[model samples]
Target: MSAGTGQRAAAPGPSTQKPRGIDRVLAFVERAGNALPNPVVLFTVLFGVVAVVSTALALADVSVTVPGTDDTKQITGLLTGAGVRWLVENLVTNFAAFPPIAAVLLMIMAVGVAERAGLLETAMRATLARAPRAFLPYLVALVACQAHMMSDVAAIVLPPLAAVVFKSAGRHPAAGLIGGFACVTAGYAAGFTIGSLDALYTGITQQAVAVLSDTHHADVNILANYFFTAASSLVLGLIGGFLISRVLEPRLPAYTATADAPDASESEDIRLTPAERRGLLCTGLVVAVYAAVVLSLWLPNGAPLRGEGGALVPSPLLTGIVPVLFGGFLLAGVTYGFTVKTLSGSEGVVAAMTDSVKNMSGYVVMMFVAAQVIAVFNWSNLGVLLAVKAAALLKSVGLTGFGALVAFILLVSCLNLVILSGSALWSLIGPVFVPAFMLLGMSPALSQAAFRIGDSATAVITPMNPYVFLLLALLQRYEPEARLGTLISRLAIFVVPFLVAWLGILAVFYGFDLPLGPGAGISLK
Candidate 1:
């Protein structure tokens, strides 16, 4: 195929043209996607440029120091001069230290094998096609959330599939694309079915507490919101689909041009010859047995997944959740890989690992820059000061529970435009709010949950979301006229529903003093 010629398979027979509606909307989106700079490249360059400039200015003593701090003490910094090398070194170490990267690595291990074997893609498409119409949207949302359990699946998979789903449904393709992207990307932080974000945030908050108080008692669990979020996810997903169908669809304009649909392609469905099927089935059974064994460990009188002396909060199982997640993904991936021809032999597993790490390049860049930004802010004590002051201000106004949670969400949503990483924002705020709220009869788990809501709800609208701009590019494939404003405005209608529904669920959870998970309580007691 020529470079610019769009790929095609078997296009569905054309439906009646809605000349004044979806056609115009798709044209606008396509145009807008083409107009914007590649977001990944833009962010990568901006981050690199900012890091170099900031380091240089700090070295030259030309950078403006935040007031109330001694210029020589905070500003005559080494970020540029002697510090540049140190910054890079520290960033490397920090990147290494970030457990999420490791989780991403592990997930990719199995993921690559699954993909190479063609099992993953086939399963996804087959599942999509088989999903009931009434349940289709929720299934899409579920799959999108689960995509995070695998590395970068949403960015590479969902946009294209979304268009397919919409087109297949006789709805506007862009709407399906945008909705899927929104659910996957925006709800990135809320996958309580597994323990990825829950683990990262908990560790950060716990570390923050230790920094302030020097105590182990401050430990928070990664699966703190497991049940709460899993249930709430279903609710938010329903709201998401509703928003797309009612508000978002009406707001989008009719497409002026029809873009040819990409041909749906699938890898050879590995018909597991009966022997292979039994092997695969046995492998799955072994996994289930192993999982049951591991989970049973946490149910005993004082397991780590349990809180103190049988409690669930502050459980060691929760604290060390990253490794468990790694293990689960690794086991499943390896099981499927080895049992099926996908793994073929040991060499294939090694190749899968290699490919997984190779895909880490973009994340490596983002993390390197993100680490420097965070380290500098921390070193300067600026984040601490701001967080402390913010906490005090909120406390003074008697903000607590639902209202305070809402306010925090709003603040973080706005803050997302300037700072996007969940860990970065929480690292700054966790120190202050976790303890402050804990003192106000709230638990660190609840505080983190609130932050997550704020963090996720605005992700689709935030320019800082790493993948938001990628969606725009996909939009260009179908609608060449769409712009950032067009995308944001359409997403805005969802902003209210998401914010309200999420906050409302949280409020009820808090008001009832419900457990977010097995040991994850809404209150400190």
Candidate 2:
């Protein structure tokens, strides 16, 4: 029982009828999503919209009383001379200071070193080789879920690799591609450990929470959603594994390997050489030493990492997680790179870091627009005003509690179809919802957890995701005629179940009043 063989053995005969309803809906979604402007342009347009609305609101003297305060806050007009000066002064600073962009760029520097050294690919191959056939799908799903720690590296690497693994085991390669793509994109928010995304989202969440009250200015830990997301990874992996094994593979036409398919010998040749083995050993040693040092700074009695009054939540270790992540990854990557001879000297390491930043050129461009939009939104006070009004409306309609959380999840899930970037979406929506949820007695961490559920579940089926195109391109290698609809239809099967199961998990967490993460609970005190 080799890996993927059970899926090949269980393959059902092809069906004559098409799944018309799902196909139609997916086609419509694809068309509508593709019609949306590029994210950069979208953010630019949003910035203009915010400016116009802010001017109009200010002209109307629109004001909202601060919740738990008697003072009224008036909208600030971005078109005013004072606003113009503020914008000009802050434009560079906004882009330079945008937390997520900075964090992602820094993390990628280290990840790039590991990726260029071939450590990540080799590690994946080694892991797959050892995975039991009966649990191959589950293993692949788990690996894909965890791959978020490497950012887009998984999207670019996994689908083709999974296809190769399945094809070698006589399973439909497209099934493998879909399964890998599903977990990577659809389970994007669920990971075993904190990564760039946690850093990215937490920064956005903190900014949003800060707008409401200074007392709420506690720094959101990158691991704020750690416990829930760790559980989510398991659930997503299991559900994804089941769908890949039971539903997706059985329906696909039997795979006939094209010349374009990875050479069968490639999988056989994937063994780590002595040098690569040394690289892994060296990386592990370095990471262990780094972890020991970090723990020593945090775990001992009266350690410096502890917060004032010996609290952990606002501790220096949690607050300084981004730099710690950067340093840890940097050391691990350098160790592996040198061991494997991928890095000959400091020059090689510098090149890897430089290339990593070059890879983020598009993101950097998008962030410029995003930063301006966020700045204008903040200056206009529209986000605060909207949250205040929305909170009042929700209270009036009695939509608070678990039901409101459910609605919020559904809304963000739908929004995922049109907006693909999690950080971008969060930066746009977080201000409105974080405050509104807080007003309704939810913690920012809980609101963030709900956002993660919605943001991730629908990603696989959404054409708006930039990676879907990449997945489609990968699919074409096996199924020459495969269309966007093909991948969407295959991956869409898991989206509903994932959403339902994930929402159920959230409900249970709420019912039990479970902590979302260390020192982070479902409701504000």
Instruction: Please tell me which predicted candidate would have the highest TM-score against the true structure.
Output: 2
The global C-alpha lDDT for each of the candidates, from Candidate 1 onward, is 0.61, 0.81
Runs off by more than 4 Å, candidate 1: 1-123, 249-259, 263-284, 296-316, 358-389
Candidate 2 global TM-score: 0.91
* Clashes (candidate 1): 31
User: For residues 243-272, could you state the per-residue lDDT of candidate 2 as single tens digits?
Assistant: 999999999876777887666786665567
Instruction: Write down the worst ten-residue block by lDDT for model 2.
Output: 1-10
> lDDT tens string, model 1, 1-525?
121122111222223433445435534544554555543454445445545655555555553322233432333243455566666567667556654455545545655665665445545565575565556666676666555544356556875676677666656668777888877766766665563455556656654544224211344555777766776677877877777777665666774435444533321221235545554575568679878977887876755467666765456666666677667655665676666656767787778778867876665565555444445544443334444455567778978557787777898877655566676677556665775565456777788888878887777766555465677667766666555545666766666777788788888888888887656688765
Q: After superposition, how far is residue 420 of candidate 2 from its true place, in Å?
A: 1.6
Error of 1 at 93 (Å): 9.3
